[model samples]
Target: MFADRAHAAPARQDPSLGSTDDPERGDVPGWVLITLMTAGLVVLIWALAGPALTNLFEQAIARVSGL
Candidate 1:
């Protein structure tokens, strides 16, 4: 005695492999991914530049003081 009409229709399988039946599982949105990548790049750049800048400043001071 199933009365639901929606369930009466046959379910269709997608031709595309690895595709989700639901839209929510798709890859992260473009803007969100870009923001995340930008944040990561900024952090990486700062980490690499910090020590190099400190060393350069120390060398400059030493040269000026004849040390």
Candidate 2:
């Protein structure tokens, strides 16, 4: 009997990514991840540094006013 090419596997599948068949399952969309990380970092920096900045500004204003 002749060999059957019909039952043969596909030529390539990436090992780093197991399969690309399910596009939705494995990876987060780049824009969505970047937006989330940017928002989180903004909130973190604001929370940590906002009060200090405000106090510094108030001190500068007080010094300017000679009070």
Indicate which candidate wins on lDDT: 2
Q: 43 in model 1: Cα distance from truth in Å?
A: 0.7
- Residues 1-67, candidate 1: write the lDDT tens digits: 5678666977677667545667866566887999999999999998999999999999999999999
Backbone clashes under 3 angstroms, per model: 0, 0
Q: What TM-score does model 2 achieve against the real structure?
A: 0.54
TM-score of 1: 0.40
Model 2, which residues run further than 4 Å from truth?
Answer: 1-28
Give residue 10's lDDT in candidate 1 (0 to 100).
75
